[model samples]
Every structure is written in C-alpha cells, then in structure tokens.
Target: MKTHLYKMLLAAGIILFSISSCKKFGDTNIDPTRSSNMDPSVQLTTAQLRFSGDLNVNERTSFMMTMPLVQHIAGSYSNRWGGIYFNSPNVMGVLWEDSYGSDLVNIIDAVKRTTDVAAQSNLNAVCRIMKVYSFARMTDLYGDIPYSEAGLGIKAKFDTQAEIYDSFFRELTAASVQLNTARDAVKGDIFYNGDINAWKKFANSLHLRLAMRLVKINPTKAKTEAQLAFNAGVFTSNADICKTVHEDIQNPYEEVGKGNIKGNGVSASFFNGGAVPGRFTTPFLNQLNSTNDPRMKYMVKNYVDLPGGNPLNRIDITEPLLAVTGGYFGVNPGNYIWDDFKSAIAITVPGVGAYSALNNDQKAQPANFLLRFNAPFLHLTYAEVELLLAEATFRFGATFGGTASSHYQKGIEAAMLQLSLFPGGPTIPSTEINAFLQGNALIAGRELELINTQLWITLFLNGPEAYANWRRSGFPVLTPGTNAEEPGESLTIPRRFEYPYTEEEQNRVNFEKVLPALGGVDSWNGRVWWDKL
Candidate 1:
C-alpha cells in the first residue's frame, strides 16, 4: 500500500502553509484571506482517485448482491442471503455514498476549478466525461437522482432517469468536442495518463453503453445515439480500454481482506468472508464447463488442496477429493443453508470435494493474484465496444464494415487478452481461444441471447454493468433464489437497489418528490425508467 508521491507532497505543503499563515496573521481590520484556490491538475487527480476507488467499491459490493442475484455465486448463510434477497439496506448504502458523497462531489469541484483554465481544457474535458459517467451510474442504479442541480449548496431537485440520460449524452458529446479542440496535454489522469485522444474514445464508448441501455425503452433514441457514438469513434482495440493504474494507492480488495479474515485464514477475497469459503454458483460453473471456456481455469480454483495444511487430514482416504471426483462443484444456489463457522467441507456431498471458490493460491501474497492490488479499475474496454457493435450491427444495421461474427470474434479475442493483466493469472492459449470461438459462434436465430450471455461472462468482476445489461437485455435468464426471510415475496430478481435511507431523512423534500415516480416507496423490485422490460 504505497502512498503516491504527489499525495505526500500535497500534505506536506498544506501543513507548511498552515504553520506559516499562523505565524504571520495578526490583522483583524485587513480582511483575512477569504478565497481558496487549487491547481486543476491536483483537483483532477483527487477526482480520479475518488472515482476509481468508488468504482472498485461499487464492483466489490455488487459481487455480493447483483452477482448472486444473477446467480454468478451462491450465498451459504442468512447474512449472505441478504444480498440476494435485498434485505440489507445498510450494506447496500455504500453504493450511494461512493457515487454521491465522493466521486460526484469531487468531480463537480474539479469542473469548477478547471473551467477557466484554457491550458487545462483536456483536464476539464476529462472532468466532464467523468461527471457524466458517475451520474449515469447513479441514475442507472437508483432511477431519478439529483443530477441537473446536484452537489450545489442549495436544495437540489431530482431529475428523471430519461432527463439524466439525455444530459449524459450531451455532456459526453460536448466533452468529446472539447477534447478534439484540446491545446495542452492533461495531467493527473489516472485512467488515460494525459492521452486526450483516449479520453475522447472513452467518452464515445461510454455514450454507446448509455445509448444501448435505452434500447428497450426508447428504440428510436437508442438507435440514433448508438450511431452517433459509433460515428464519434469508440475504442479501436484493447489498447484503448480505459482503466485506472494502481501504482501508489492501495487496492480496495486488500483493504477488504484485512477486515475480514478469521482464525480459519480464509481470505475475504473469497466472498468477503460472508459465506464461509464462498463457492461459485452451479449455473456459473456449468456455463464455463459446458463451453470448455479456458477462462474457467483462471477464474475458479478447484478445492483439491487447502492452505495451512488439510483440515480433513484425518478423514478416510477411500473417498477421492471432490476435485478428483466431480471436477470442482459449485454450490447450487438456495440448495442448502447453514450458520457461519460451519465447515464448508461438511456441507459438500460425497465425492464432490469441497465447493470451489475463487482461486486462493496467492492468498498469502502481498496482493491477491486473482484480485491484484495493481490491477486496473476498468472503465471501458474495446472488448465491450466490439460486443456492442456486434449487437448494434445486428439490430440497427450499423455500418461498421464488419459482420456480427467478426465483431464477436474480435470481442472474444480482446476479452481473453484483457485477462492477462491479472498478476499471476492464467493465460489462454491461442488454440483454446479459437476452439471457444468455433464452438460458441453467434447463430442467426439466437445471436442476441448468445452475444449478451457472453457479455455477462466477459463482464465478470464488473458487476454493476453486468447487472444493468441483464436488466435491459434480459439475456442469460436467471431464476431468483428462494429466501426464507422473504417467503411471502415473489422470487423475482430485484430491478434496482432502494435509495439510501439517509436520503429520506436528510433530503426529505427531494426524496419524497422522487418516491412516487419510484413506485410510491423505495422497493427493490421497482424498475428504473430505462428498464422497460
């Protein structure tokens, strides 16, 4: 967890200024300094750090909630079940805090600071792009939010989801145009490192994602915006993917690990220690196994051996390890439940070995290999762009000069390439990748479903986007797990998380105004405006 040099310098400078000002000031009649100023680059850097941290936090939280709702993993206990069943308001509130309290606020301040600096136009454009990205994510998660007038000291008004999306498109468009006219390089851009062109590509790529999200609710607008984004030039390759580099800041996963490890030594990276030794869902493993997806090996760890020596050393050796017998079984969602501290091994069926979870070979290492400290916080990727293009071409007759299959193949290739970034992660050989593409070709009748399902798989570790895609596209149809706590409620998957409770108490007027549009009360099943399906 190395601190950034700039952060250290900034802190030292602040302390020095405070001491020097204290020594010099004795003038009551002459007005003491009332104005404060910050370098736009410093503001940009702070905003980028806050935004990336928020994104990581959001993704990690979503893994416990939406990932299981979509059946990517299974909950083994009552508390773990909260995420799946939408029973934990406090646990879900972090998403709201991260987006609004941190990223959105810092980004607005950055925009204000950068506005008048012509030399900092590139940084200003990046700020605008990030503001749109942050707001779009907020609207997607909570429906109407404080967007148009959010972050101002005055009482803010909530904007409709449609209005927010419209503003996102306009902001991205304006940012892209501003980027094109940039005269100076950007600094403190954690995602793109002063590359204005890459920032432009990010803006357009994000626009495409936002546009496609509107497809089900507003097909005409979706098609038009998608085309505009395409014409504006989205990611051209994996090289153009936007992600924050982690050279100095500590990874959020490392922080989670520190708070969650118990005497058993199971890393919190394995489901944040919610469900003992969290196991992948049966459906998720089955999809990979059936497709012979090479990614499965990298993403999942077989329970062949346990760290700190085998706890089952005394068990009879007649029965084979579960990995040997059944080849790494995932817990079937809702099939079994138990209290925490109950051995994960005890729940396993005979000859199936202990349930498989994420690989923990690097658990003792400084940075978890699978969840590396230095791993980039992905914002956009060429893989996603190509997949979206494949869908757009098929649905809108988009003239990107390629067939759906070509875009699909490129997407698969890029996704495979992207995984190489994980420290000590597995690499899929070219032959295996080609075989996967050959077997999983986009058939004419089921192209949309197949493409979106693959998108779901590729979007692993990117939970919010995956959840949004699942909502809008309705692909990879998953059955909601039965929850005993909410037995009277239907098992339909939640459409969106409820607004944070603080909003109701603190921002009562605005919160109340938005509640009717959110189905008179904030409930998990209430769908956002773009979620027409």
Candidate 2:
C-alpha cells in the first residue's frame, strides 16, 4: 500500500542506481548533472511520509521491547524475553536508524529547502516543529545524540541531552509563534493537511509534553514551558488531536501484525499455529479486568482453540472452530517456564478458550479494528493533553480554572470517545463510562499515582510514552521481569537503549567522545539527562 511519496522515493532510488551504473568502473570524472534536488513541496511530502513511517516503526519496535519491559505483554517462548530482560540490542538499533536516518534527515532537508522563502514560511515552521518532535524522541530514548551536527556528513558529533532538550523548547516556542504569524498555508502536511492553526496546536502540545518531562529535573523550567504551552493553546478536544491518516499507504502496525502471524516478523506468541511466543501479561489484563474497562474487549481477543487446517492459522475468523469460556489467559511477565501452545490450549472449561490475544477482530472484514491497515497513526491526543493539564494543576498548582478532578474526568471521557474511531471497536456505553469515572475518583493524596496509572492505561499500544512516563512518575510500581536479575545485568529495568553498533563502528571517534557522559559505557543502565528525581 505505497503512497505517492513512497513511489517518489522508489523512483529516486532507481534513478540513483541507474546513474551510478552508467559511470564506468573507476571513472575519475564526476557528473555535475547527476543532481538529486527536489522541490520544497516534494521534500516536505517526503519528510511527512518518513516521519509517519518512523512513528509506525517505532511503535512496532517498542511493542517487542519496551512493551514487555513495562509488563504490558510477556513472551512465552521466543527471544522477546531478552527484550524484557534488557538483552536486545538489534531491536533498539531499528529505532535509531528509523528516527535519525529516515525521519530526521528528511525533515532537516525539508526545512533547509523552505528557508528564506516568504511563501514557504509556514512550511518552514511545520518542518521545524517536526524536527523538534523527532529530536525530542531521540534524546528521550538515548541521552546524547547527533543533534546539532546530525544529517551533515561523517564528522557529526553528539549533542548533550540537556542541549538537545533546550533546543527543543526554543524551537517549539519559535515555531508556535511563526505558525501564528504566517498567513501562508503549508503544502504536503499529511498530519494537519495545511491547517496552520492545527499545526500550531500540535507544536504547543508537543512543547507541553517536553516541558512535563523536565518536571522532576527542572521544576522552574517545566512550569515556565508548561505555562507557555497553555498560552499558545494545546489540544482542546479530539478534533485537535494530531494523527496521520492512512490512505494509499497501509498502517505499519497492520503489516507488523501480519508478519508476526506469518512467522516472518517479531514473534507475538499468539496462537498462529505451532508454538506460541508471546501473549498479554497478567498485570496488564488484570488492571482492565478488575476495572471492567470497556476498552479491554476492544483491545484484546480471547484465545480460541481451533482444530487446525490452514498453515497461517489466522485468528480473525468470524466463526470460532471451538468456543469456550475463560479462554482469555495472560502470562506472568518474567516467567519463561510457561509452555507455549500446549499451556495456552489447556483449558478446563468445556466451551471456553484459555488465553487472550491482543485484538485481532475481523468483524469489519478487511479492516481489523485495532489492527486495521488504515487506522490512524496517532501522535498526540486530547486525552493526553487533559491528563497532563490535570497533573500540572495538581503538582504545580497552575491556575487552569478547574481542579485536577475535572481534568481527570475530561481525560477519561476523551479517551473513551477516542476509541470509537476504530472501525469495529466496541461502543463504550455512557453508562459504563460514567460508572468507571465515578468509581475512580481522584483522591487528593493519591492523585499522582491515579493520574499516572490512568495515563498508562490510556496510552496502550504507545509503549515509548508509557515507558517514559513510568520512568518519570514511578506510578503503579512495576516489578522487573523474572529474568531481570540475570548475571551481569542490573536488576532494575533499563533506563535507556544503548547506542546502535553502527555508531560505534562507523563513527567511532564521535561515539567514544560521548561515552564519558553515558557513564563511560554504552549500556542500557545509563539514564538520559531528564530522567532525574
């Protein structure tokens, strides 16, 4: 499901290959005409596509690693346990390549193309906003990164995480102002579709998110930026949420799910035949089950035991081969002793399935609700904004004209309504929503814990954000995976991903220079600058 942007990239790749092939072996003369310049509009489109694709790839990568580390899901037989236990370097490297190589570089190129052009001032502002978003994610994941000198040639050096965060605050603030002043509309903006006002909101919303990250480390700066973001206007409702809608291009999550089921991608351990490699974790399911959260049914599917036939063993069948109760079972995180397919199928109830899988519903035919190929890839949501505002009100006592309770309820309501966007998602009745909200009132003393936990639940499938918040807030105290205490590794959950091996091999000098700041070792135990108490 490639889009026009992807086709352009493909064509460019082919053209480059052809030009290289035409050059005689060891030819000394370089062809000046063999240029690869694109117009600002084309470059902007490419950047937007790359950014959206990077988000999808990041989400999939996190599902295999951080998702388990945070106990959202657990592996049954595969090396996913290695991820939960902090032993997966290859998985972490994908995120580095996608963000730096694909996302950031394209955004940088687009921003460069639009610079000094009066007509493209808004486009330039949009590019800057995207660049900040990309760089923020990179710094958040790994302490120091190639920021200031990134996307330039080989001699690029790493910028300290603090420096990167400072630039993010400045860039977002400037971009917000520029967006407000520029009257020109941006072209090729897939996220907001030329809506300068929406882009402004997104810029400020992203600013708010980055500011909150500094709450523990720099309260003064956090308060300042948070207030700035409020004045600039962040997301106020679902209409203001930032997402890239899937059109000609398929959702990356859907592709990942298909590959997993086909045994060609990350092993998810769902009953796709043979041995199950992973399943939802007990803690994750328990939280939703106990709360009677309507989203549970929308987000997960009960394990169905089938009599076997097709090799793919697709789980999205309309009619179950076998029906049973208590089929939805979650594995305990860190416990690798559980048998795979055998254990999942060992059901006592006559007509009940034994284990649950993350939702693989096919009620809407080609669109699989949560796993739909055309599902919107969300960046920021009104729900998150409301929750963050609630936290700001509770922690810093910023006057937002409402108490934390009001913001919390608004967040919950927005989250519930947000799920309805899925094609075949459950209709969360007003009754269930009200019941959950009433029963889960934010107590004055335990407001932080409740807010963070609810944020965790709302940010499902958003592993990086959830992991970052958990690191910062330390709410709903989670236990390390069973194998976390393995020899030579720290028992604590990983604070950051180690730098990719390519950096060590190709940019050894610059990489070594940053080692001292990373505790003189590129290891997962090293914390980023903002992950402070």
Candidate 3:
C-alpha cells in the first residue's frame, strides 16, 4: 500500500511539470537579432579564398589557352580547330556571375565593415580596382555583361559592354588616383603585401594596358593615357610583373588524388593519363619554322611516333619530329624534351610505360600564375609599350619621318629579352629572332604584321588583350584548319563570347536595354565599341 501511494504521487508531479514546461518553451528561445550579430569578417575571407581559385581555373583553361584552338595548334576529341565550340558554355557564364555575385559583392561588404579604418579604405580601393579589372575582361570577352547593379542580390541590373568599358576605365582611373592618397597600407593584401606604391604601380600599368587597347578606335586618347602611365612610372622589368605563386601542396586551383574533397581542380585531360596538348596549326608552325624562329623549340612537342622514323621501342633514337598538321598541343612550349634523354624525373623509369602514364606526382607541376606573382602575369610591360610605340611610329613613318625598321628591331629585341624571364628558357633565341627580322624587309605592309605577330606571341598567356589585338589587327594571319567542325565558314575566328545566361534570366530588363545597341540579342559576333576593326 505504501509503495503504490509513492508511485502515484511521482506520476502526478511529472505530469504537472510537463504541462508547465510546454507553456513556457517559446519564451526560453534566444533572440533572433543575436544571429544577425554574427561576425561577417570570417565569411568575407572565405569569399576571397574562393575567388582566388575561381580566377585561376578560368584564366588557365579558357582564356589563356583558347587561342591554341583559334590558331590550330591544339586538337580536341573532334580534331577541329579555329573555333571553340560551346562544349561547356556554362563555364563562361558561371564564372562571370560568380565574379560579381560571390566575390566582388562580398568584398565590398567586407571593406565597408572592416574595423581598421585605413585597412578598410585600402580594401575598398582594392576591390574597386579588382572589379574593374575583372569586369573589363568580362566585357572584352563577352560583348555585354551585367555590371551596374550586378551584385545587388535579387535586385541586380545588366549593363552594356560599352557602358561596362566606360565604367571600367572610370573606376580604374579613380582607383589609380585613390592609390596616390596617403592612406595606411592594406595588411592582408596577398597580392602586393600591403605596399600601396606597388598597388599604385599596378594601377598605372593596368591603366596603360586598357588605354593601349583602345588605340584602333581612339588613338589620341589611348596615346594620352599611355603617356600619362609612362610618365607615372610603371613596371620596367620582370620583377614588376604581377603573378601569384603556389606551394607544392596548396597549389593554386590544382587538383589532388582520389577521394580528396579539397582537391583544387582537375581538367578532363588531367584525369586521363595525359593532358590535352594545345598544339599549333600547320600554317602557324610552318611560318615560325620558315623564319627559324627560336620560340618554336620552346612551344612545340612531339608525342607521337613519326612514320618510318622510329618504332615504339627504338633505343637511343632522335626525338620525333612533329608537324602540326591540325591542332594545338603542349602545356609549356619548353616543357617537352626533343629526345628521350630529356624526359621528366617521373617519366624516366623504363617500366612506367612512358611520360603519358605518369601519376600527378610523377608529372610536371603546372606553375599557377596570378597578378600578385610578377614573373609572368604582366598587365603592362615596358617592352610591350615600347613595341606598341614602335608599331605606331612605323605605321605613320611618313609623318614621323624616321627609320621605322630600327624601332621595329628594338621592339623585337625587347620582346625576345622578355622571354628570357619565363619559367622555362626564352621562347625564342635572340639570334634567331634578329635573323628573321633582318631577312624580312621591314616595309610598311610587312612591318605591321611583323610587329603585331611578335606582340601576339609575347602576350601569349595574356588572353583578353591578345584576343582584342587579334580582332583589331588580324595579325599573324591565322589560317583555319581543314579539319574544323564548321568547315563551310570562311576563316571564322570568334570575336567574342556570348552574353552570360544569368543576365537573360535574372536581369532581363536591363539586358534587353543594351540589346538594340549591340546589333541584336544573341549576337556573339558583336564587337566592343573600342574594337574598331
């Protein structure tokens, strides 16, 4: 009887407590406002990190190497060259959207909220410059892109290519001027290490680059900007070249092994035992060989066994001679060895089957370059500017009344010297480069091609400017491969990438506003305002 009475009292107490707790549960929750107070600094940092990788991947694959297809030095599965088919059209659009939505917008927010006033100011300036640089590239590639209200979450609007270019120039100019202001340095600048002077120099170099780009359309203004940038003093040597470096481990947007979630990135070719070589077209290669250009050895490789020259197991044989009959190949022109003796460390093991079968560790590590690491990411080099001057002076030799050939030679020499600073040996030998110029009469018609071709080659990794120059001058006379998918089209080199998909879906109103001015919607062939040709 005592036990039964005790159990009954315990059950009654439990029920009473449960009823009271349920009534008060809603009142016990934390304030909703407290969640909003969470620090945004860490989130912004994460955005920056993501942007770095995104930029590196997009730059290396599509922009830097696409010309190989245009020039017919490389081949894909279809073996077509001269135009990049929309194999992965989304790659272009997604990158553009991410730049504004995921990267720049977050950066702007971080700059506004940073506790260190001086750091905050510099960060804002940096973001502005970066945005200008990025957007300028976007507009240059894809005729018109969303700009003015791009990163306003769901409230973004699209801007015209013309407007985008104008904004880029204006913002770049403003950022350059801002750099001149005496503000404390940005502490976490992974690119220039908080050096405002370096940032200023970079700004000026970029300004000069952008200005020079408009030479065909606005020579006078271009000349003025170039002169101003020159007078301000920009990068004169390789040390001033901007690039980002990477460690053996934590490399810039590179891939890791199987089951690795944090692997940087891997191209389709990387997964296969070999990389897709962006080989050269026959015409481009033949021209270089005919001139005995030194850069040929640096850029071409022979992976296949030559017909009747050597068998698969030939011992102590000479390197296979490659005739670029169709497409582009090779990672770095200099990476490949002409002979078996020169195979990479990982490829030397006889039983490993060949260089093609080597694992990631066994293969060559690609040097990831960015604006921060200065060996190769040249925004505006003194040599390039000098060459442009040479071209301009030569073009109007009648008015200038000087030996155009001399300036042309000087430009050639400077470009050749610039190659010496590449990760590998110089693309071309100085002697060969000089010999070619000497052999070819530097007349008006020939001289322009000569200067522009060299310029195109020197600015290899720099795609945006190179593409612009190609469209403007049509130098190097790229001949379409006979094996191109669109064989019927006449020497069709793509002028620009199509407008990103996001603009049509999200920013439809503003996108349509710029359509009439661009000839029509869905016109990838439309040229930027500055591209006079």
Candidate 4:
C-alpha cells in the first residue's frame, strides 16, 4: 500500500508540472513587435552601416571592373563586370530582418499605437525618413524594389525601380516638411542622435545627392534641385558629415572576411614576411606615388617596399601553384593567389586579413569602416557643391555665376581639406594644391571633364554617388581595364549591378513586369533610369 501511494504521488507531480509549464511557455508578458525591440526606423540603420562595406568592396573591384569599361582598365580576372563584390550575404540578411521579419512591423505598429499629437508627429517623421532612406538605397543598389506595398508581409508587391525612385524624392520632400514642423523629440534618431537640425541637413543633403542623379536624364530638374538644396544650407562642412561606427570591440560581423580572427583564424600565407600582405595594383600605386598625395599612406600599406621603393615582382620559384600564388608579396602567372599558394598555406579567407598576426591585437587596424563617429556619411559636402558650381560655371558660363576655373580651384581645395579630416589623412600644402591646379587647369573645351574628374577622386568611398556623377559628366578620361578580352569588352563603363538572382526566383510576377527592360542578371552593362545619356 505504501509503494502504490508513492508511485501515484510521483505521477501526479509530473502531470502538475507539465500543465503549469504549458500555461506560461509562450506568455512572457513581452510583445516581440515593440518599437524598442524592433522598429524599422532603428533596424534600417543596418543598411546604412552595410553601405560603407559595400562601397569599399565595389571601389576595390572598380579599378578592374568599372574602370576598365571606361579605359586603362588594369586588373585581369574572371569577373569582367568589375567585381561588383559583396563582403557578406549580410546585406540581404539585414534587409530581411529589418523589413519583413521584425523592424518594419514594429515601426508600423508604433505609428498605430501613438495618438498623442507630439508623439505621433515625431514617430511619423522618423518612420517616413527611415522607410524612404532604406527604400532609396535598395532601389539604388538593385532597382525595381517593392515600395508602395513593401513591409506589408505576404501582401507586398514589387514596385518599378523608376517609380520607386520617384517616390523616394517625394517622400524625402514630405518628410522634410514634416520634420520642419514642431514635435516632441524624435524617439530614436540613431543616425543623428535625435537632433532635428542635423536630420534636416541630412534630408537636404540626400536631396542634393538624388538631384545629381538626374544629370543625364533631367538636367533642368537636377540643377533646380541642387540650387534649392544649396539655398537650404545643407552640410555646411565636414562636421555635418554622416557615417556609422563600430565599437573598438569586434563583433562577429565587424571585420573583413579573410582578416577576421574569430571567423577564419590565422594562416601563414596571409602574413608572409613583413608585407601587410595585400598590396594594391601597380598602376594605382604609381598614380598616387606620382601625385605625391598624402592619402596613399593612409589608404594602402607599403610592406614590401616603401613608397619610393622598387616595384618588386615575385615571379620565379617552382612551388605548387597554390603555395606560390598565396604569398602576401607576389602575384602568379594566371592571377591565382589562394589556388597557387595552397601548399605553402592552407586556409580560406572571406575577406582581408589582419595586418598583425595576433588574433586579438587591440591595436589591429580596425576593419575598413562601414561608418564611424569621426567620419560622417557624406550626403553632400561643400567640396561636392563647389565642384558642381565649377562645372556649371564652365558649361553654362557666368549665367551660373563663378568662373569655371575659380570654382574648380575651390572644389579641389575643399576636397583636400575634406581628406585632412580623416585619421592619418593627407595634408596637401596650400601652395602645392594651388600649384597642382594651376599646372592642370582645364581649357575651354576640357573644363567640364576636369572638374568632374576632380570630384570623382574626391568622392572616393562613395560608389553610387560617384557612378551617378560619372554617368552625368563623363569625366576623368579613364581607360578600360588591361584585359579587354572579356566578353563584355564593348562597353566603356558598367551601368549598374545586375539585379540579385533571388529577386527573379522568389518574386516572379513582379520580376516578369520588369523583365522586358532588364539587361539580364549577369549584365552589369545595363544603365539605371538616370543614366539615359
């Protein structure tokens, strides 16, 4: 009787515990869709953060890919499309998380919950700005994004790239007007720290950037928008520049792929001898060297030989292709690095390696920045404005006011000054800068290209904007890459990245609508709507 009683008690206890657990399992008393937890306004900042990474990758590849399309293209590789490279699948990952998965839902829900006049105004402005900014960037990158019906979950429909671009400007204008009105402080202005003035400036700067995009397709509209932005006093100087920052501490997604210790660990081939391991192309090296520009040191490391040193070629040695190709100091016959050097070093790198061998070297050069505290994301700067003025004056004459050459001179000076703001950035002597400009002054026929080219170099790390300007002015006199044998050899510069493959696969109906106009998934030669010229 005692044994049976004990067994019955044990069974009862188990059943009691199971029932209690089920009652509280999915009810933590917390809403997953709260704004503080996952608002689109906050989450979309990831896109802005990822922008810098993508810019760096694109800039690195453009030397061979896009630059070659124009002229004097130097690098040889299987990717003829200028290596429109992405460091991570994270761009899409972040997009999905922020848009459909959580952030978007929270932002819309917050807008619904807030009825207080001040709270509603603040929330609405933030949401509009973020949604517009996110959609603008997405459309800029891939084209034909879902705008009108986006973030509506399964009901979302793809919008035309052209239409989306139109909505972007309209939304920016509307948001700016809304922001201009009084309200409670913006609840979460991550980019600008809830500063209304800064947001206004950002909005206008974005306007300037978008307006410039219309250069080829709608010059009148572009000029009008630029003038309006100027009148509004957008981005008066470098302090107003915007950029994302990574904590000095490393996060899983923080460092470049091959270089991240947490990700790939260390390999001997990546740190051969004293070379920083990844050297730039000889032409790129030579150009900076010739310019005597100060930025070269900050931009590229000189491990093999310092700036004035010989161009060392590591051509000899009959080691296995993988081992030979993998060394930090040399290039192989067929342009193989990891493949040729595998015997010497066995490892796979997703991106760049650490400059120092230590895994947690606190002082390791930080990852090429996505954005940063000191370096602001440049919506537009005085330098760019000056360059535009220079070009406008030159092409349209005094009707546009300043002398082309004078405006050009100012533009160059502003660019030099802008570079000075970066850590270890170059310091051009005023005399040297003046001398360089005087020496390379643009003539009546060449002023337009000259001004645009200077603007191009100044706009480094800003790919989409620079590419748009290039489409407009056709400046800088670039030659196509050295390898003209690639299949798309006929074009001068890649128009845009082909839309992602997944877009066509998953969003078929919307994809079909735009298919007739698409240049195909592999075709970087297709131009954006603004690049009609």
Model 2: worst 10 consecutive residues (lDDT sum): 257-266
Output the TM-score of candidate 4. 0.64
lDDT (10s digit) by residue, model 2, range 69-182: 777766534425333464666667766754454445557767777787888899889999988887776678778888888766445788888888899989999988887444
Across residues 340-372, which tens digit of lDDT does each residue of candidate 3 receive?
122322233233344432111221112222111
Give each model a TM-score. 0.81, 0.81, 0.68, 0.64
Model 1, residue 131: C-alpha shift (Å): 0.8
lDDT of 1 by residue, 471-496 (tens): 99998877776645445243677788
**Candidate 3 residue-wise lDDT at 149:** 56
> How big is the RMSD of model 3?
14.3
Off by over 4 Å in 2: 1-36, 52-56, 76-83, 180-182, 247-278, 305-327, 336-368, 483-490
- Of 1 and 3, which scores higher on TM-score? 1
Clash count for candidate 3 is 27
* lDDT per residue as tens, model 4, 135-236: 565465445655666544343566776676677677667667677446766543445656777777777677766776676777787777766665565666
Q: After superposition, how far is residue 411 of candidate 1 from its true place, in Å?
A: 1.0
